[model samples]
Target: MSSKMEKFSVLMSVYHSDNPHYLDVALHSIYDDQLVKPDQIIIVADGELLQTQNDIIGKFISHCPNGIAELLQLPYNVGLAAALNTGLEHCRNNLVARMDSDDISSPDRFQKQITFMSTHTEIDVCGSYIDEIDPVTETFISTRKVPLTHNEIIVFARKRSPFSHPSVVFRKNKVISVGGYPPFRKSQDFALWSKMIVNDAKFANISDVLLRMRTGNDMMARRGISHLKYEIKVLGYQRKIGFITTGQFIHVLAIRTFFRILPGNFKKVVYKIIRKCYG
Candidate 1:
């Protein structure tokens, strides 16, 4: 399918604490470096941003084609889930690609995803593998791959996320039909995927790396008590929805909680082992 015939929107949320430089690079990758540029780039400013951040956004906007970049500034920070839900409301296109403020997308990311989605009309959501890079050095760290078929995705979702949240392009209406993203501080994507799965929304993942995700000690540090709480909440929802059996929930929760409590360094090692085992 020609990208020109299937116009799509790029959706992203940025907050005060995000790195300005990273955000600039992310926007550039999805626009200047992309083979198929989005028809519209909708960025939700979750809260007040620094002057530097605003300046970077201004630079990006100035370089974009007229009406291609849209910035929605919120009066206050509403976190990721709420911010994304707000952004989704403004997405004029049926297909919306999700991008993180810190990730660098491959030049052909949008082209590949749009082509796959256009051909696979039944699949409402599509994601792909990601190459994890060091935040400081910008060197390759690992490749996080997800299941590539609907059945495999459903089975994988019972234990872990079936798709990389930042690497996904999904049908906007399908996501909204499931109540959009739940208002959670963390693991919102996990909950959203579970809801979509139970609601019979089809899913798939391209068997190729489409984005380079930044991961480092700071990322590992986030897997603490708060993250564990949200993880359990998502697991409980899965159990209630019958997406996962009680035994499966308990088993997965036990393992996740153990890893969550580990020191940042130890958690990093555990992450590598888990990825290697599953990759």
Candidate 2:
């Protein structure tokens, strides 16, 4: 079989600290899935991993029913963007998928997504909905549906993350064409997606909740003010890119501030309501 038709690279950038606890859930999901065999599960770990890699991941690496896994330990923390870019450099296949250490994917996640991408030639990036599971609280935190249209995605960043970064799959050629992920601020995925869209990259999403994300937004209040600061920065970026005018950006800021001042879960409820109303 052709290389493009045969192999699919799965890039998983993780910290060594994450091992049998959360890592197993993520790896086992891929292993249990019968559809796609990873070309290589490139794990960008740290020096702390070198010792534990042999004990923890070594067995799974050998026994993964589909893919053969490998380890890449960095001397220091290069951050998520750098780690993912390093893995992408080693990817031999045309297709790429992201898997976080903490999320669980549907059994057919890779197979279904790669198949859709194969059928749809125009689209370079595709993401799926997520069943946001708060493992700590042991409660279902509702579902997150990624944007299905280019325009929806542009609007998505203004509120919550439209594309679950770990749930996204894309063509390697297209990702490289846009210069891959940038090591900028906390929003590396945001930066990369914006760059891709600005370059006319086509995006799509599977409406189904094909992944389960471990929700940890309970601490948003501690950094509430900082979160607003990031939104403002992103709005500024939009203005610079000509997506939103200065006046429109300020309008968004005004509405965001108004919502912030409301009672507990008010903004959250509003977002859920908007999803339902729109759906």
Candidate 3:
């Protein structure tokens, strides 16, 4: 089915800390280059953005075809998970394509994902490989590949998140029925995927790069001790919810904690090596 016949909404969230210029590029990537454009783009402002950020979004909305962009503003910074939940609620379509505020979706990102979902009706959630890029220059640093089948995804989820969050297009109702993103600051995507797996949702990957994800020191910094605490909490919840066994949960928790404390520079190097091996 064409995208127009099988409609989907693009859901995104932004906050004060997000770069306005990157946001502009992200919006254009979605609105401009696509075989099939989104029926509606829902952007949830997690909190009050800077005047410049507001202006960037306002200008995009103004130029959008009528009723294409739906902007929802929150009174405070409620973090990504909560903000995304709000955006999900406002989505008018069953299939919602996830996008990050600063990441650029490939021109065929939506087209590919929607086409896959349309054919593989059993796949409740699907994503694709991504090109990790330098946030400032947008230079492709490396590719991140994910498992392509449901069983592989389930096993991979036991060790790491199987899908690139922003590269995914999932069923809104399936996600919501599993309680949506948990109220965590980081690893919210991992948490949600865990819940969905426990709920027996089918998963897959397209095996083609669909998004250019921006990465920088800021992202590595977010992997510090505090974030590790929340990740452990998420892992424990996963174990409790039976998505993972006690042994698998403990093993992953230990490895993740060790990496969390590594120097940001070293962690970046380690990440590159891993991506190369998996790429």
- Identify the leading candidate in terms of TM-score: 1
| Runs in model 3 lying further than 4 Å from the true structure | 1-5, 216-218
lDDT for model 3 comes to 0.89
| Superposed model 1: Cα runs more than 4 Å off | 1-5
Clashing pairs in 3: none
| TM-score for candidate 2 | 0.83
For candidate 1, write residues 45-122 as lDDT tens digits.
999999999999988999999999989999999999999999999999999999999999999999999988887788
Model 2 spans with C-alpha error above 4 angstroms: 1-6, 16-20, 50-54, 65-67, 137-139, 154-160, 216-223, 255-279
Kindly indicate the candidate among 1 and 2 with the higher TM-score. 1
Clashes found in each candidate (C-alpha, N, C closer than 3 A): 0, 0, 0
TM-score rank order: 1, 3, 2
Tell me how far the alpha carbon of residue 188 in candidate 3 is from the true structure, in angstroms, after superposition: 0.8
How well is each residue in 1-279 modelled by candidate 3, as lDDT tens digits? 333346899999999999999999999998887778999999999989999999989998998899999789999999999999999999999999999989999998888889888877778999999998899999877788999999999988888899999999999999999999998887899999999988899999998998999985457655788788888888988998998899998899888888888988888787767677754
Top of the candidates by lDDT? 1
Q: What lDDT does the true structure give each of the candidates?
A: 0.91, 0.72, 0.89
